[model samples]
Target: MKVGLFIPCFVNELYPHVAMATLELLEGYGVDVAYPMEQSCCGQPLANNGDSSGACDAALRFTGVFKDFDYVVAPSGSCVSHVTHHYPWYIADNADFQRLQPRVFEIVEFLQDVLKVDKLPKPVHFPHKVSIHQSCHGLRELHHASPSELMIPYQSRLERILQLVDGIEIGQPERRDECCGFGGTFSVDEADVSVAMGRDRVAQHEATGAEYIVGADPSCLMHMGGIIRHNGRAIRPLHVVEILTGRGGAA
Candidate 1:
């Protein structure tokens, strides 16, 4: 299958290693993965900021760039959720949008549900105490992990994926699936509220005694990471793909 890698704009610019780790993880599975140079932002920020015209243009551009692939996989849950859930409103009459809607997936969900990866192809080891931070989009929209509010039996694709790695002990935070206060434009619109929420989330992760805060979404990590760095906290942020490929390092 031809899988197109949809790297989010922030991740592409700020955390290139996360993109590299994602590519490495997919390629490790022997899947045919391609990064389309024509790919750009999925129009989430524009849509969030009430720029409907610009967002619609970006939506069309996204479908045009990635519609040919059998599957469009992104490491970011927010972007995938936007493409899957919101793009229809932007490109309701576009055939490509309809065709590609069900084809896009966040990387963790892609591996667990679509790829059905029970274990890694090779023995991957990451001897670290890590905690899972479920992004709001990944938790609520994509259902990557069971939300605490749902009151259902707890389950996390992120934790399950981490279990596949040798010597990796998964720790649950006090609020296991809480948001890291990085709701794209939400962070910018409410800077004080965002940082306050981020500090609380980071403190919970630190309470787990985890050395790394591993999450599927880089946006959440980036938000909490700033809090950790600003406070001189020992816990570091990591992307799930990095742990899967044994590449988590100061990300």
Candidate 2:
């Protein structure tokens, strides 16, 4: 299948390795993935800030860049959710463009749903207890919670894939689907509330006695990881894709 890689602005600039790991994982699964260098932000930052016009321009640019791909996949769930959900709302007039929204899949969802590999290319070992933080966009917006009804508010394809990895024990947080306080602009605008929420989330993870925290979206991990580091805690954060790519390590 022909797939286009959509690297969010933050992933391209700040978390390039996450994107790289995603590409490596897809290619290892014998999938044909292409990176459109012209692709930039998914226009989520603008849209979340209530600037729909600016977001529309960015959305048009994004749509123009990957319109021909069979599927658009991204490592960051929030970015994928933004393009798939928000873009159409911003550009409702373009019927053809709106159709492409459903074609976009977060990396984990694509791997589990499209690839459906019975066995992973390699074994991953993380001999430590780990807690997972579910990002709001991937959880609520993208309906990442639909797979499992176990008390956890969001159940993602990534969590299912992680179960296949060897020696990794996935634990749960206090509030399964609570926000990690990394709502893009929400963090900057409401600094105190953001930190408070993050601190609370980290505390719950700590209570789990887990060595690290993991999640599908890097933005939430980035925020909570920073708080964990600031407090000099031993627990670290990692992306779920990083684990699936067989690159599991502390933070």
Candidate 3:
């Protein structure tokens, strides 16, 4: 099946390697992946900021750019969640929107659910402690992991995917599903509150003695990585694709 690779604008600009890693990982599975150069934002920022007109334009552009693919996959859960759940606000849930809805998928869910990837085609040997950071959209919208409030038996698609690595040990934080405070435009509007939440998340991960904090969203990783560097902390923030592709991290 032909797949379209949708790299969020933040990831394309700030973390291009993550996009490359995602492409590499998918190509390894023998899936035909295409990256449309005309692609832009998924209108998440505009929608979050209440600019309905601007967001509608973006939503239309995104649909035109990616409508032909059988599946549109991105490494970020937030962007994918926005396209699947929020796009209907700007664009009608007509034939195009309905077809695109089920076709769009976050990389983790695409790999686990669609591809049925139990393990990597090539084995990865990380040999380090990693704490999983469940981003708000990934946790609540995509249902990547069972939220703590539900009080159900804990389960994580991210954790399960990481377990496939040869020597990786999973670390648990005190507050497992708390947000990193990088809620799209939320971080910029409330910088002080955002920094405080990020610091608290960093401290929680540090308490577990994890060397790396991994998650599906680069926005979350970027937020925590800045805080970790400023505080001279030992923890490293990594996009989950970095580990899965075994590229440019403590391997």
RMSD of each: 1.2, 2.2, 1.2
lDDT of 2 by residue, 47-139 (tens): 988899999998899888988888999988898888887787888677667767778999888887788776677777767787877778887
Candidate 1 structure lDDT: 0.89
Which candidate has the top score in lDDT? 3
Q: Rank the candidates by TM-score, best first.
A: 3, 1, 2
**Model 1 lDDT per residue over 162-228, tens place:** 8899999999899777778888889989999999999999999999999999888899999998898
Q: Pick the candidate with the highest TM-score.
A: 3
TM-score of each: 0.97, 0.93, 0.97
Q: Arrange candidates by lDDT, highest first: which order?
A: 3, 1, 2
Local distance difference test, per candidate? 0.89, 0.83, 0.91
Ten-residue region with minimum lDDT total, candidate 3 = 242-251
Instruction: Candidate 3: count the clashes.
Output: 0
lDDT of 1 at 141: 90
lDDT of 3 by residue, 21-40 (tens): 99999999999999999998
Positional deviation of 105 in candidate 2, in angstroms?
A: 0.4
